[model samples]
Target: MKRLFYSSAIYTALGLLSGLFYREMSRANNFDGYSQLNVTHTHMLVLGTIMFLVFMLVEKNFSLTRHQKLFNWFFVTYHIGLLLTVAMQMTNGIMTIKGIEVSPAIAGMSGLGHIFLTVAFILFYILLNKSAFKNKK
Candidate 1:
């Protein structure tokens, strides 16, 4: 529960900062075109902060740590996925604002990050089901 709450808090900070970054960077460059950074703030808040808040609640009700391995896997994979996706977005946004040519490889990597997040999401549901079905200790 503590870990989950801390993760949510950290993500809350990251989300706010990312939004500020997007606003300031675009303004500094006088950017008017759409960029992935436009959505980075939302992605961080939803995926990072909100997801973890829900996780903490799930933990309180279902004792997610009962299945420690699955919980750990879900936690690590989720972080990797979110960070990779957001990093790519920020990189692409910066490149766009600076008039640099964006590479296809970044998109490919971002897709991979989405894959990780999908897998993590599945693992999380599985964990939830497992805990919910378990007998009280």
Candidate 2:
């Protein structure tokens, strides 16, 4: 939870910075570059920060695995998806900053990230169920 609070704080700060610099960015030679930056900001905050907080809460409230295996798997998949998503998004932002269009690689990685995120969520749900059962026993 403390980690999450810090993450949220940083995310809010980034949002503020993005907003404050918007006008300046728009008037610059790289005006079009602002769009991808905004997008990456949203992606990082929404998934990397918010979703990670939710994952932490779930893990803390429920000791879902007898061993660390399931917990580690969940964390790994979640971070992999989150990192890939953010990286592709940042790459796309860089292209935008250079006035280039988004590439197919970005599109493909985004799709894969979505799939992995879904799978991660499913794993979390399964872990929660298992934990609940264990508690009952």
Q: Rate the local accuracy (lDDT) of all candidates.
A: 0.93, 0.67
Q: 69-130, model 1: which lDDT tens digit per residue?
A: 99999999999999999999999989998999999999998999999999999999999989
Clashing pairs in 2: none
* Top lDDT prediction, candidate number: 1
As for model 1, its CA RMSD to the true structure in angstroms is: 1.8
Q: Which ten contiguous residues of candidate 1 have the minimum total lDDT?
A: 128-137
Please state the error at residue 88 of candidate 2 in Å. 1.0
Candidate 2 residue spans exceeding 4 A from truth = 1-28, 32-34, 65-67, 135-137
Clashes of each: 0, 0
Clashing pairs in 1: none
Compute the lDDT of residue 31 as modeled in candidate 2: 65
Tens digits of per-residue lDDT for model 2, 14-54: 55555455445556644653555566667666776676667
* Candidate 1 Cα outliers beyond 4 Å, as residue runs: none
**Candidate 2, position 10, lDDT:** 65
